[model samples]
Target: MIALLLALGSSLAYGCADFLGGLGARKAHVLRTVMVAAPASLAIELLLWPVLGASFDPGAIGWGAASGVASAVAFALLYKTLALGPMNVLSPVTALVSAALPVGVGLIQGERLGTAGLLGLPLALIAVVLVSAGHGAGSSRPSRTALLLAFGAGAAIALQLVFLHQAPADSGVAPLIVGRAVSTAVTLTAAGVLRRRLGREKPAYAMSAAAGVLDSVANLLFLIAVRSGDLTVVAVITALYPVGTVLLARSVLAERIHRGQLVGLGTAAVAVSLLALTST
Candidate 1:
């Protein structure tokens, strides 16, 4: 029960960060946002380390680094897709795919579902769709390339979860910290190259750094949640981050929620209930 709550909290934080990062990227550069966010995340991690009393194994470091790379790629692509495609189409598609992979992997690894959990599956799907639904009632056409990139991002996200889950529990928070560092480095390097080509660097660099900090913190919370609970349940709850994204969009971006989104929210509530019931 406690783990599930932590996972849910992580999801909310992550969703807000993603939404804000996306907005920040639009106002600046994707790489820039990542660079800024990374260090902020690292600082938070460092601060929490003593309290968490987390330690890491060498193998955990490797896996964390790999997850970091995957995360960097995923966010880069996700932001790029958001820039090019409609939020309604891109967010849901990416989120659904991302959630599905871990669930599928868990099943393959022999994670069993109770009756409530089995029923919750569809609700989870509906919740994702609902939470990601946009207010663009008239926008129908979406770019194929953007959709493909979103799918790629989703795949990367799934891989991130898989690697995180595989990290040894005794490895403590080392994997997560290392993963954030690697992700931050990779994103900054990529941003540097892009900025050099475009002849613009300052603001972009700053933004990426800020975004990187938020990303790192979010990852740490997720790691803590996973360490304490079932990975499948934690992953699913965390993946429901779109709910936070939608709420933020409504407030900060003044974006309107459609009827579908309301339905989605309701469905998500049901899904959460189901997940809670099943986790027991």
Candidate 2:
């Protein structure tokens, strides 16, 4: 129960980070954002190290680094897609794909669901879709390229989650930190390349750095959650990070709440209830 709460908390924090990062990216360079945020994340991790009593095994470190690179790519692609496509179309599509992959993988790995949990699955899916729904009218049609990129970002996110789940439990938070470092480095490198090609990249870099820090913190919490709890439930709960994005849109972006989002939130509540009831 405690672990489950922690996992949910992690998801909420991550959602906030992603929301803020997205907003920040609009005003700054993704690479610069990542660069600035990476150090901030490192500092936070270092501060929490002794308290968490976390350490790293070589295997965990390697896997974590790989996960980081995947995550960095995922965020970069997601941001790019958002910049290019309508939020209404892109967000839900990417989110659905991302959430579905892990659920599918878990099922394949023989994670059985109870009746309530089975019911919860579809509701959770609806909740995610609703959460991803954006306010205001969007383009009548979205570009195929943007759609493809959104799906690709989803795949990258799935890979990151799976790899993180596979990291050694005993490695503590070191693997998480390593993963963040790798992600930060990769994003920064990509930013440099993009800047050279585009001839204007500072704002994007700054936004990416800020997003990276929040993402790092979220990743750390998620790692801790997975280490201490069932992966299936943890993944499901954490996947709901889009809820935070919706809330942010309402408060920060002054986007009106859609009926769909309210429904989604309600669905999530019921899904969570079902998960809790079924888990025991």
Candidate 3:
């Protein structure tokens, strides 16, 4: 029950972070937006280290660094795939693949689920796809390159979560600190390489920073939740983040929520309820 709550909190935070990040990206280059977000995330993690306590064990550094690399890859590929068009299809595909991989990993590692969990997991995966679905499919279908990038991005996302889970439990927030630092460096390097292409418009510093802070919080919660709960359950719950994003869009951006997403929201609630009941 505690883990379920933490995972749900993580999902909400992740959703909020993505919403803000999307807003920030609209005002400037994606790299530029990440430049701010990454540093902000690192700063928050550094602050968290003193409070949560940290140990830079080999497992912490190695797995954290691995997650950081996967994060960078996921960030780049995801944005590129979205830019290539047909976000409606590609976004859900990415989300589904990301959730599915971690679930598979957890099962292969000998995690067992009860009947309720078994039922809820598939519902949660389906909910992830439906909630991530958008209104338009864009004018053109996604190209082969876009499809490959989408798959790669999803795999990278899954790897990030798995690597984080692999970190030493005694390390506290040190893995997050290391991962954020590495991602920050990658963001800076990418920004440097593409400086000329970044354009002259003022970046949405506030929005980007807020996103970073929220993202750090989400990661912290996810790390804690995974440590205490089954990875299969926690991962599926976390992947429901798209529900938050879709709801936020409707309220803040006044974007219309489609029928599919509405059904997804309901399905996710039922899935979470079942999981919580079984956990109890």
* Candidate with best TM-score: 3
The global Cα lDDT (0 to 1) of model 3 is 0.92
Tens digit per residue, CA lDDT, model 3, 30-117 = 8888888999999999988889999998999999999998999899999999988689999998998889999999999999989999
In candidate 1, which residue ranges exceed 4 Å CA deviation? 136-138, 197-213
Task: Report, for every candidate in turn, its global Cα lDDT versus the true structure.
Answer: 0.78, 0.77, 0.92
User: TM-score of each candidate?
Assistant: 0.90, 0.89, 0.98
For candidate 1, lDDT tens digit of each residue in 66-134?
998998889778777877878778888899888888888878888888898888876887788677767
Worst lDDT 10-window in candidate 2: 198-207
Candidate 1 vs candidate 3: the TM-score winner is 3
Ranking by lDDT: 3, 1, 2
- Candidate 2's clash total is 22
Q: Please give me the total number of clashing residue pairs in predicted model 1.
A: 23
Q: Which residue segments of model 2 deviate by more than 4 Å?
A: 135-139, 196-213
